[model samples]
Target chain A: MTRLLTLACAVFTMTLVGCSESGSGDDTLTVGFSQVGAESGWRTAETESIRSEAEARGIELKFSDAQDKQENQIKALNTFIAQGVDAIILAPKVETGWEPVLKKAKKRGIPVILVDRGVEVEDESLYVTLIASDFIHEGEQAAKWLAEKTGGKANIAELQGTPAASAAIERKQGFEQEIAKHPGMKIIKSQTGDFTRSKGKEVMEAMLKGEGGDEINAVYAHNDDMALGAIQAIEEAGKKPGEDIIIVSIDGVRGAFEAMVAGKLNCTIECNPLLGPMAFDAVEKALAGEEQPKRIVVETTIYDQSIAADVIDSRKY
Target chain B: MPEALKKLLWPLAALGVLLLFNTAMNPAFFSITISDGRLTGSLVDVLDRATPVILLALGMTLVIATAGVDLSVGAVMAMAGSLAAMLLVDMQAHLSAVIVLTLGVCALAGLWNGVLVSIVGIQPIVATLILMVAGRGIAQLMTDGQIIPIDSSPGFAFLGGGTFLGLPFTITLAVSAVVLTIVVIRFTALGLFIESVGGNETASRYAGLSVRGVRLSVYTFTGLCAGLAGLIYASDITAADANYAGLYLELDAILAVVLGGTSLMGGRFYLAGSVVGALIIQTLNTTILMTEINGASVPVEYNLVIKALVVFVVCLLQSETVKQMIMRRRAVHD
Candidate 1:
């Protein structure tokens, strides 16, 4: 029994020594990270950013890919709590059923930071902060740019993203609210593109055909992928996309930047998926018990043909 | 109508009716204007978009004829498109090389599905479902989970966007594929073999029919069709978005097959009906989009409801009760 006990003690000491040596410093912070699967390019980018940030900051990240399941995420959180992690970072796939797990984390005094998306929690103190991009503001920026570029006199076709998704709903809401301010700008046709390039192109083709592709003056897609698709549809119709119909969309993916550079897409509002650095900073602050904003809204940029040349090459995603 | 014509009649009529509705809803629906020497209009769009479904339905008709379902066609399309794009863009491969390799990969995927269903005795639905789920994720992995947009040769792009004899290449490809599938299945004993397998698997084995080869070939053909569709779709957007490329299209293919009057129970298949059914589906979708209530587009949410009603009506029209009523009415006339 003593020999086995000694063996266990030696292995535990070796693990502690190994953990102390490879991490940032002698003081290693264990952060249990439950990410909502790498289902999309954005999700993969976000996950990559977090992993790199954790490495750079010398924080131990116990990463769990939930594969877009809340139950899996909850299970990961439970495991993290069982391990008595220093802090927990949750990139929730959905926005509900998080109160119980969060409350459990709270009792253990683990500072939980919500990254990329916000979770539904009745209690105010469940999480330290939600670090996310304002999807609505991104939409508003795209619409505002379109209005300015079109001199507020344009007949638009709106290619809404996936229905009921928080981003899609917010983006659509924001665009509608902003466009409502400009009476000269009207959404002549609208359809859900399901936040994909192919659907965007198909819906845009139908939208253009319905209200006369010539009558339409602008195309507002919720993302760059859809905008790229709409551009193709417009080109197929023998109409100049950027000139005949101004194309403005959100999400500053590399493809969108390339489109803006090629004069196909007129503008793209940035929705940076690289939330890793900011998320970890918030994590560090929260763990330090320092007061942080309840919501750390990431800043975004509006890129048109003018600045696209300068920044297109620098876009990570 | 003759027996063969009767099989083709309903789906063809359904497609025609949908096109008429589209034209009525928007006069521009039927107006195919020459744009840069290519046809551009809603009708053209319907044909272009329906190409993938038509190709998918072609394979589906055979698979369903064998009383087997290949749900992986959609995902196979994603994989095939991804293989083509990634190979072409990353490896600087020739377009023909990309096409050949991609089809090869798709055929391999079908072989795996075939091996599972025929050799392992796994249920068809469950076997294809494996690829239906994992295939897209694998495609995503190949592209590093990004929409791989490639600058390809105009010749490659022509496969999707180019015109052939004043009609879109998609329509040409779909028609030729349909014709070829019909010729291959009808002229040879392949069609008979498939029907036998579907009609009675145990009896087919007892009759000395190569049941395993029939099952394998149908799946392989389905995979090849899916690969061709993936090429077209990838060429359409000039990008391979693994997640969305041919997403949920298996359901559409199956719907087209069912709409064509092919029994899901798997006998007496109609390839022409499946193609027409695909056209009807695309026409219905275009009609819905063209439909406007007082110059405002139909509420996007109600699109499904409208589709459901149309499907319900079509199903009702094909129902036994309706057929009985038609028979009674004919008797009354007599």
Candidate 2:
């Protein structure tokens, strides 16, 4: 009898809390965001964009940093659910083992939105929507730009990112798919740089020497950091990076934009990290009983030297 | 000649066999072509990439000989690289000062480890491990957790990337350092004292040898070597990656020292053997990177497996039991 009374009391209080949280006439919201650790500059930029956007929209945001651990994320999710927040945004570090916690959040009727990354699940209703950059498309854009620039007569040296990342896999696949159409275009060397500027440069140096800098026509890095590193290597080998060796890469950070404008790098395919506006829009739309797309893919632009000067100043990251 | 060859024979033969196998696998492995006034080929690539590991192995040989293991060499490399990059970025643009001061800082780090082991009487593994864990973190603090890239320092980069007399500057640097270290240690009574201390500390103490001093000197030498390597590595990449500057390289350095036929049991050492050991690892890395089955790059999953197998074969060849069996077979035939 005592246990039943406690359960009833807890549910009644939770309902009261929920009532106070969801205001009818007021344009206010409380959102809980669980972010993967800040390991890179791009991640830091994303976190800043979210905080400033939340402030602009006058939403009370509770943030949890997972520090690159799945258990921490699970704990953060449970905490958010227990607090009876209006919504939860999860930038998952991995694809699996999220269903159980998500099920608990679903039981509490708290919607979850995946940002920057996605979770694999059988049930589509677990997440309200996923707002992320299309990695495969980004790879295709890079390849397309390379093909058009080189006129299909390019011997490419690919500096891949961390070997196991989904972005690396999808990017390589998409780039190859596009490259398959061009008879003259070929990837002579593909080495893992492990997604750091130093390794990227180190690997590029080896590639430049082993493959003969004259034999190689271009470098396709999985990210701008690697491209920037490769540019240094090509220059050291006495080859003009933008002219002698066409440089193409992904991730349109401020550094890449500057490199493009400076004529050191030929092109960069954008993997838009500023998903704050879109994520908040999804949250607002979902809360208003409005139907939203299952996946909202953020559109990205390919920047080159021609318009790079104009867009470099406006680039947020 | 045969008697002398037996000391450093196994590792030398193993390196030779590995190189022959590499050449067979890739027909162009030994090919040397000049590109833009510099030697360009996989052979040159190996020498260029071998700089850091070669330096680590040189230091590791002495540490192992002194009956001490410096597991923090890799972390020391990271710390040194971070120091060099941060110093340069903060307007300390003097190349020679940056190199000298950074090496001095690493030497101090080495001195700290030496003090811990020699004075505090801690085990070498445990003593060096404190730095192994904390050193990279210190490096990260120096870099503010970023990969600091520098494009302005052309003179600084020449140490790792430039060619000297149709060969890599790193190769020349490694050879000269090895020669200098060999002369300094072998020509002086220091080498004999170090071997004696490692062979039997109690006896060496009774014989009026400064055992603590020997340990301190070896650890300090290892630190200085790691610092030099860190500079070359940073120069090669034109950046200092605090997180990954010398990740997991200590294990490889230990492996190289062992492969050079130096006894982990302490007493006696061969600097030449360690050089060959470093070359073996560098060649193995290049082989894996260059491996192509039907022009498709070997997947990342198989790279470690292939490398581990090479290590296994080299270790098995150097095993005492295998050596004993070979000797027994030769005696029976005679």
**Backbone steric clashes in candidate 1, count:** 0
- Model 2: per-residue Cα lDDT over A1-317, one tens digit each: 99999999999898767655663336668889999977667787888888889999999899999977999999999888877788999999999999999998898788899998889999989999999988889889899999999898899999888877888898998999999999999998888877777667767766665534358888899988888878877886678889989999998766778788889998988867787988899888888879999999989888898999998777665
Per-residue lDDT of candidate 2, residues B1-334 (tens digit):
6542586788888878878876676666777778667887788778778778889998888889888899999899999888988888777579888999999999999999999999999999999999998999899888766677755788888878777888878889998999999899889988899889879999999999988888998899999999999988888777787888888899989988888888887888888888888888988887776666676556766767888998899988888899799999999999
Question: Candidate 2: which pairs clash?
Answer: A254-A317
DockQ of each: 0.61, 0.31
- Taking all chains together, the TM-score of candidate 2 against the true structure is 0.88
User: Can you tell me which runs of candidate 1 are displaced by over 4 Å?
Assistant: A1-26, A291-293, B325-334
Model 1 C-alpha lDDT per residue in residues A34-94, reported as the tens digit of each score: 9988776677788888899999989889999998788999999987877777889999888
Highest lDDT against the true fold, candidate: 1
